[model samples]
Structures are given as structure tokens and as C-alpha cells.
Target chain A: MYPWIWRHLPGPLPVRILEAVVLVAGVVALLMFVVFPWAEPKLPFNNVTTPQ
Target chain B: MDPPTEVIAPVDDYDDEYEDYDDEYYEDDDYYDDEDEQPAPPPDSTARKTVRTIGELLITAGLVILLFVVYEVYVTDLISAGKQDDATQALDDQWSSNTVATDPQREVKYDLLDGQAFAKMYIPVFGPDYKFSVVEGTTDKDLEIGPGHYKGTALPGEPGNFSVAGHRVGKGAPFNDLDLLNSCDAIVVETQTQWFVYRVLPMAGEAAGWAEKQANPKCAKVSPLGAPYDKTVGQEIVLPTQGEVISQVPHFTGEVPAAQQAALMTLTTCHPRFSDRQRLIVHAVLTMSYPKAPDFVPEEMKES
Candidate 1:
């Protein structure tokens, strides 16, 4: 599946690999720094404790 | 041409075969080119398309559930751990600045700011590394910082129940192992100036009788709740309706006939580890307290 994406990417082999790495790192950074923090409060788990 | 005609038969057969091969090659190339241009046709049936849509939706749903779990189990812990460290550092700074007095009689009280650290809690059974900063409120925002001290409850070392609430499965799970506490285990609460050590009490009927005795000193000698003094360790699960678990005397369902004097601590967390269906309550009575000095450490903290 990843190879298919690599083949579709508009670059040579080395450039495609580098692009994939950069893409993956960008996704992880977004999730860790932005998406997760934004979605954390909206999640149901931590808010379970009712205020007394 | 005339010389070839005299020497050999017409090469029409060979030319026809070559033309046929060329036509076949061109047709195959056209087929591939068409595929590249317009892929396979979509399924003709609406039902098939709907099924594909449903499959995509299910995959998306699965991914969302996975991300939610990641957010709950890992991301929240990471964020809360950072918050806990910040709160601990702030508390340490406040202590070092001599903002809190060391007088044993003086009870330091904060203005009940949300997410503000007010105390530090240590459970000896959880080992030396198990310490959490206790913040000022039980709201989600406050608990995300650490275990939150229930506002209006007695402060640590005071003559009433100092109740605290923390998440059992997320937000660093400060009270994740509350159920592991055995009877007589020390749950030490440290304010800026003192360490208040409380011992876990018995569960259920014995706990109720113990509270009754504490509330009414006359009942201490004749209570039927006789689980020997050495065996008060028991576990109890209660629903959210049982708010009295945090009362000055835990399990005392009725109004006390006299003023309560025992300094107690109640740690409450969601029961069944990760579920919020019920509450797990650990009631402990203050056993000893001492003023914080430069080199003083509790014996419980020193043990393995």
C-alpha cells in the first residue's frame, strides 16, 4: 500500500522516500502538538469524574 | 521490383502478418492508455456503492476510535504529567520562598483557585516514586493538573475529612492504584509546612461502626463492628449517590450527635479501573503529623 503511494508520488526514488518521511513526521507532529490537544477536552474519558 | 517478381513469390503474406502484429500491439497499447486515462468504471448498482460507502465509513469509525483511545490513554497522560510537574515545581517554589508557615497549629489555606496546587499526596504502598500534587478543585480542568482537593473539605491535618478526587485511568491516573491500599497503610498528605499521615480504615460495617465511634465516643467501647484492630483492611465500592464517603467520618450515614474530631482523608476515584459506573472510596484516619524540617522524612517514605 505504501509502495503504491510512493509510485504515485511525483519524484525519484530518493525524493519519494524523503517526501514520505517528511509527510509522516508532519502528520505525527500535527497529531501530537495540535490535533490531540484540541481533541483531548472533547473526549469522553477524562471528563468522567463528576464535580462534587 | 521486376527482378524480385521473377525470383520470388509476392511478400504480401509476410506484410499481412506484420500488419496484423502491428494492429494487435496498437490495440493493446490503446487499452492500457484508456485504463490510465479513465480507470475501471464505477459499479452499476446503487446498493454496491452504498456498501462501499458503508465500508469506508466503518474504516473511518475504527480509525476515530483508535485515535480517541490514543488521546485518552496516552496523550492525556502526557499532558497531565506535564501539568503535574508544573504544579509540583510551583508548590516547591512556594515552600522554599517561606510563603507557608511551619507552625503546627496554623492551617494554611488557599483561595481555592482551580488548577492551583495546594498539597502533595503520597501513598506508601505505591512506593516512594508515587507522589502527586493535589490541586484545589475536582473539576476536569483542575484534575487534569493532578489529584484535586475537594473544596470545602477539611485541609490536611485538620479535624475533619480532607477529601480528594483524581482520575483512575487518565489525566496521569493519580489514584489509579487506590484499590491497592491495605488497611493501616500510610497515605501522607504534605502541606507547605507539615506532613499529615493517615491510615486506611476498614471497609463496610466495621468502617461504619468505626465512624460511629469516632462521632460518638461513647460507642467506641461497645460497638459490634469487631474486626480486630489489626485487620481493618477492606475494600468498598459505592455509587455516586454515596456522597457521605467523604464526610468527616466516612460511612456515618446519619447526623453526628456530637462534633467530629478525627482528622481523616478520603480518596475517591472511578471504580472498575477505567469505568465511571461507580466510585472507589478509601477512608483513612490521621495517625500522626509533624512539622516539616530540613532533614525530616516519614518512616513510610523510607521503606521499600
Candidate 2:
């Protein structure tokens, strides 16, 4: 479904942007949910005050 | 490894034969068999090869973790707390000295606009022995006891830009909370002689050395009650003109409307704590301004 959407969207330019957004979001969500929390306090720059 | 069984058997047979043959037979056979049994225990296991490699990896990991923890917990807090303590100790020592303790002296006197302010800032939160002179209307260099008055600016009492600078961490971070100052908090400037009260008025970026220009605009004759001010306009009250200056760091410098000129007491410190990419500015106003009363005076400075 995603590949189809990437190939044909309402606008050619906007579709590329949309595709980029999806890629970035995937990376961020992966880091936050899978990589980061698992790393716990050991994560880089996680020492100081963190978001409650 | 144990000797072959055949070799040990022969040696044992020889001994038995000697025992049966008697002393004469032993004397005839001149060969001596005095070797100790139970060969020296095999050298300790050669396991260090693996252990060394593992040890190195653990050490590296431990170092990295330790550095991260220290930076997070101690570096920032220690710097701030140490600085505060130093400032406080400096004040306490000043008061405890025989000069201050023996006399009834009032170094700081009262005033409304520029009379009563922070006569001096003593950060007790820094450390036990850390202290620096806070000259009335002087830069960090003038203090001459470590922190100095900033070069090329007005003294706290005179006007213009009553600029001061101190460390954010190390050498007793006197201005660590500089970033946290809100739009209107109290910034009192008191001196051993008198007090000069002022309000905070941060400048916009591009206006100039805004951080170094925190002073009482009321004393400078710039009016918060004067004509309506347009921040974009190049207006002058008493601060030095922003020369053709370029900074390695970025700063905010918008002008304060004439009406808001007397609304703040600005303070600034290096931004992000560890990086000098920008400055953390806090704008505080004068809340309470009064002289150190005779009773409040340090005895050392009092007249005999």
C-alpha cells in the first residue's frame, strides 16, 4: 500500500515530501520505542533532566 | 606429565633389590636416587589471554559510562553550587573580618532609582572559600580577586552599561542561573558604599552588546514613562553604541520601548552550559532597594 502511494499521489512534488516524512517518522519511532528506551539511562545525552 | 609407568617400575625394583642386598650392595652401586617425587605443581592455568581481552573491554565501557554520569550529575550541578558557595563565603569572610565585626559601618546606603541596589553579590552557593569583589559600577576585572570587571563599560554606579561577567561553571559559577531569570525578577546591585537599583531590559539581537548593558535606565534618564518607543528604531539612552561588532555567538538585541525601559535587570551566561553557541539571558527588575542599615553593616568598614 505504501509503495503504491509513493508511486502515485495527488501531486508529484508533495508525494516525494510525504514519502520523506514517512521514512523519517519510521526511523524516529523505531529509535524511540525500540532502541532508546531499551538502552535506558545509558542512552547518549540522557543524563540531565529528561521529560517526565 | 607423570613419567612412563615402565621407568618408575624399574626405579622401584632397583630400590627393592638394594634393600634386600644390604649396605655392602648399596655401597658398590654409586648411583644416587635423590629426586623428589610429586613434580612441582603444574604452572597456573594460562587463562589470562582471554581475561585480558575481556578486562580491556570492560574498562573501556566503564570509562565511557563514568564520563557520561559525571557530566550529567556532577559537572553542571557542582559548577553552579560551587560558584554560589564561593560567592557566599566571600561575603561571610568580608563580614567576619575584624574590620567589619568591630565597627558599626554601613557601606550600602538607600535610594529609589540608583541609590539602593545589590551593594555586592555574594554567591554563598559557590564554595566555602570562593569570593570575588563586586565593585559598584565596575566590570568583572575591577574586582581584582579572581572575577574581573568587563572591559570598556560603565561602572554600576555611573550608568551606561553596568556590565559584569563571571563563570557559568568552574571558577565559582556566579551567573549559572542567569538563563533562568524571567521577564521580571529582582536584580539588586549593592555596593559597600551605596546601592544602585535598576530594572532589567534585554536588548534585541543586532542592537549590540545587550548582555553587558544591564543597568537602571531610570538613573540614566531614559524614561519608561517617556515617548512611545519603537523597538526597531536606533534609540540611545545611556548604553554604549553597538559598534561594528561580530561575535562567535548569537544573541538577542531588540530595543526596549521607552515605556518598558525601566522594566528589567538583565543578566547573561554562556548558553547550553557546555557550548558557547549562544547566551542564556535573564531579565529581572528591581524588587526591593535599600541600604545596609548601620546594624546590618559589616564592622570592619566602620569608623573607629
Candidate 3:
């Protein structure tokens, strides 16, 4: 999986490294802001309030 | 493949890469390196490729769930702390702009807009830095900003319960340490005008010392309840369905008896941290309320 990602990141050594960082950061941001918050209500994990 | 001088690939061009390793390993084997020593089996064998695919699939699944856990415990806290700070800052701005209304004679009405910060709660025992913005609603969205006040419950210093709900494990975890509070620890609430100081009631097995506990300087002003409320303790665990814990008299019904309706504050959070199967509730009774004064800090309000 990691090698696949490494392979897809285009450019020379320095440029590929920078792109990989950007790609990882983008994934983290998406999970943090959109995916996780959207999934919060659907998941039963952090149900703090009463069922009312 | 080349002059022995160029045996190693430049490490730059991708073509001559593992192609050489393949040739070197399999040049001799037909089945094994010792047998035909054939060219490194095309890139990778079907078996090796399948194994890699399965391994990657499991790793991807594991990482996604791990990321979700990280979002729940750490990411959400980061997001919500920023939100809580904003709410607190807005409330501070509003409070600072208010003209003095220090009249003990007249009644003061606290009208809190939905989702707005209406009060600030502090657990003196939790230390001076333990304050949280008390917003007006208990919905998840509202709580993401700070501890939320349960709607329809009493407001601060009122006659019934001023119930609040906060996350126990994440989203700022305003009540993460709630269980640590023992009998008679003061929980102070600051509104526009008054500082309502409350003290935790006796815990289940500690009620026998209610009188002795009240003798503490911090508890001196916190009076015990009568009848319907005499049994309510400082801490309890109730199922998520027990909404009655926020009633005018927790776990009790009937029109509130004027004498029995003690002004109380209830803090509810998910119990057994990181899980929400039950609720851990902390109940405190109003001990005293004084008009806000610049130099007047409550004795129970300690930094640490």
C-alpha cells in the first residue's frame, strides 16, 4: 500500500517527498473535519447524552 | 547486462531497478534459485502478489479504525477546544460590557439565547483553571463548544435543577474528572450578576457524615435537602435512558414542593470514560450566591 502511494507520487526525490507530505496532510484534514464529524452521530462510541 | 563497472542501477532511473535483482536471483533456477535459476520470476509471482494485496487490505482496514479512534479522542478535542475558547471569549466580552446591576432588592432575569454561553462553571477542587463555558443547549453541536445546560432544567441559582451535560472522554472533556469530586466540594457558577456557589452532597455510603461534612468551612453554607431529595447523592451512575435524573427533584416526581425544591446543579457525563453506555452524575446544592464583585472571590474558589 505504501509503495503504491510512493509510486503514484510523481516527480524527483525532493518533489515526491513534498507531494507525499501534502497527500498525507490532506487525508488527515479530511478525516478530522469531514469524515469523522459526519460519522460521529452514526457511531455508538461517544454517546454522552441521554436518549431524549 | 552491462560492463561490470555499471553493475548497480544508478538508483535514479527506475527501469534497470529490481529487473537486475530478478536476473541475478533467478538466472540459474527454473523452479528455485538452485534449480533453473531463471530470471527473477516476472516482477512478482501470482502468489506473492496475492499475499501483498491481502496484507495491504488488512492494514488499510486497521488504519481506518485507528484513525477514527484518533478523531474521537484527539481530533475532536482539538476542534472543540478552539470552539470552547471562542464561546468563552464571547461570553467574557459580553460580561465585561454589562453595566453594574448590583441590586439585591430587585429580581434579575437571565435570558439565555439558544446555543449561547449563559454561565461559566468552575470546579474549585478541579483547580482554578477548571472553568468551562456553560452554553444553553445540550445537543451535540452545542456541547462541542462547551458543557451544555439541559434545556427546561433550572438556570443558575434557580429553584430546581440547573442540569448540565458534558463529554467525559473527548470534545474538550469538560467533565472528565467529575468523579474525583468528593462530598462538599464546591462547584461555582458565574452568571451575568451572581456567583452561585454549590457543594456536592454526600455520596451513597457517605451520607452518615452529612452533618459532619457540612461542618467544613466550604460546606457551611450548603444546606441539606428535605424529604424527596434527602436521598440524592453527590455521585451516581444511571442508564442512558434515565432522563429523570435532571428533574426538579432527581428521580422524583409530583409538583415540586416549594420547601423541597432546593436549588441544585447537576453535572452529567458518560461514565467509565471512553464509553457511553451509562451516565455518571454529580449533584450539588446551592450553598450561597452573591452579587458579582471585582474584589469578591468566593472562599471556595481556589486556584489549585
Candidate 4:
């Protein structure tokens, strides 16, 4: 899939590889920093209270 | 020619002939292919492999999320509902066996083990069938059984704030409809011998005057009974920090007064349903009391 995406990217081989790397990294960062945090509270797993 | 005699060509002639042959061999793609004789894999196959792997990964992630949803929504409710039944039975047994301690000075004293069933709560505003066993502690294990009373807070029918907490979505969702409770709606707490009726207060700042009234002994006659207070709409909801809403007089700006003449109640649950970002709170003052004998039901419960 990544190679297919890279092939479709509008660049030479080296530039396309770089762009794919950057795109993957951006997606991972978004999931880590923004998406998961926003979604965690909306999920119903962590609200149970134990003595803290 | 010359009868096959040993006739040697010049070395330069031989070298030029060899050089020509080498150039032809180097430029011919077929010559190199014939040497190694292995066909290269198609580029599309590599792309297909990657796509298949990614598809599998996504399916696995989707399954994991589904499992979590099942555990959160269904499994937890099943477990909590079973625990609630057990708690209700235990409370009944305790009541029948006459094991509960009563104090003339304090109304009732609950020296209960953690997670023990102590009382029952009935909210007429939610519906006639809205009742839950009140557990002793607010820990996760205790709350799994039902709504949990905050430790060190006043017990049911006491003069101070008797605070309790329950889950809004999972774990039987005892307080799921707490937001629907309106001003002056009844939240009745039943002990072994008495039933204490508490009425929800009006919005946030409206309690400021009531707090002052509670502090002065002369305002004892200002009871919460009689006609229901007007349901003040569009009041801004207040999300106080932990321990702030459960104070003897909620949001009391003056010195915290002692719990004496007036009894108050605080019910807390997670806000916005299925999210614990903030707390949804309801504060009520005790309006009336009655003995448990002769099948006494409050007027609020009797109302349609």
C-alpha cells in the first residue's frame, strides 16, 4: 500500500519516498497526540473510580 | 591456402577482433539474461502484498475496537446488574434481621464494611421504578453494585450534605437520568426504619440565599415542602471541583456552617453521558420524613 501510494505521488522516486515517509509520520503523530486523546474520554472504559 | 601451414596473424589484428566481440556481448540484454536465467518478480505483486498486509492490520484493529465496545457497554452492565441484585438482597436481609444501628442524636449510624449495602434510593422524578441500592463506599468495586455514598459524608436523613456518586453510562447507570430531575423533584432515601425525602434545589446561585438561611437558627421554619418551586430554566450548569459541591451548604461563600437543623443531599454522576470530563451534580434539601411502617409511600411517588 505504501509503495502504491508512493508510486502515485507526483514526484521523482527519491522525492516520492520522502513524501510517503512524511505522510506516514504525520498520520502517526496525529493519532498519538490528537485523535486518541480526544477519543479516550468519549470511550466508556476509564471512568470507573478506584481509590486514588 | 598455403596447405594449412602454421600462419600466425598479427597480435594487433587479434586484439581488435576481440574488442569488437566484447562490445557486442556487453550491449546485448539477452546475453546477460542467459547467464543468470532467473525471471524478476513483477512490480505489481510487491504492491499487492503490501496492500493485503495493510488490509489485515486494519481488520484486526477494527475487531479490537469492537471487543472494547462490547466489554464497555454490555459486559460491564451485566456484571453491575448482578452485583446490584446481590446488594439489594443483603440490604433486605440486614433490615429483616434488625442488624442496623440507630441513634436518637444522629438518626442512623452506618458502620458498614466497604462495598456493603446500607440504604436504598428512590428518585420519583426518573420514574416510579427508579430505585437503587446505596452502597457504602465510592470505590469502583462498591459502585459496581449500585450508587455509592461518599465516605465521611453525612448518611441518609442527616442534617448535612449526604453525597453519593454513580456512573452515568456503564455499571448499571444508576444516575443515568439525573439530568432529567427538575427543581423540587423528590429524591427519597430509605433506611431500615425511616424514609427521608429530599427535594432538588433551584439552579446554582439560587442556593446562596438558602445557605444563609441554613446558617441562621431563626430560619428553621423555611421548609422545602408545599408547592413545587418554579422550574427555573436556562440556568448555567455549574461543575464544581471535587468536594466543592458536597459541602454542607453547596457553594457556600460564608463560613461553612455545622450540620444541624436542615438536611441536604448531593447526587453526582459523570457529565454529558458516556464521558467523565465533568460532573453533573444535583443538590437537594430534606423536605419531610416518615416512619417505614404501614406501607408508607410519599406523595411525590404517588403522583403521576
Docking quality band of candidate 1, CAPRI definitions: incorrect
> What C-alpha lDDT, on a 0 to 100 scale, does residue B95 get in candidate 1?
76
Q: What would the per-residue lDDT of candidate 4 be over residues B197-225, giving only the tens digit for each residue?
A: 87766554544456565454322433332
Off by over 4 Å in 1: A1-9, A12-51, B1-54, B99-111, B205-234, B251-259
lDDT per residue for candidate 2 within B3-24, as digits (tens), equals 7876789999999888888876
Q: After superposition, how far is residue B190 of candidate 2 from its true place, in Å?
A: 2.0
Tell me the lDDT of model 3 at B6: 71
Task: Highest TM-score: give the candidate number.
Answer: 3
Clashing pairs in 1: none
Query: lDDT of each structure?
Result: 0.73, 0.40, 0.82, 0.69
Candidate 1 TM-score to native: 0.71
How far in Å is the alpha carbon of B248 misplaced in model 1? 2.9
- Best-to-worst ranking by DockQ: 3, 1, 4, 2
User: In terms of lDDT, which candidate is stronger, 1 or 3?
Assistant: 3
Runs of candidate 2 with Cα error greater than 4 angstroms are A1-52, B1-65, B68-119, B122-148, B169-173, B202-266, B283-289, B295-304
Give the winner by lDDT.
3
lDDT of 3 by residue, A1-52 (tens): 6788899888899999999999889988887788878988787756677643
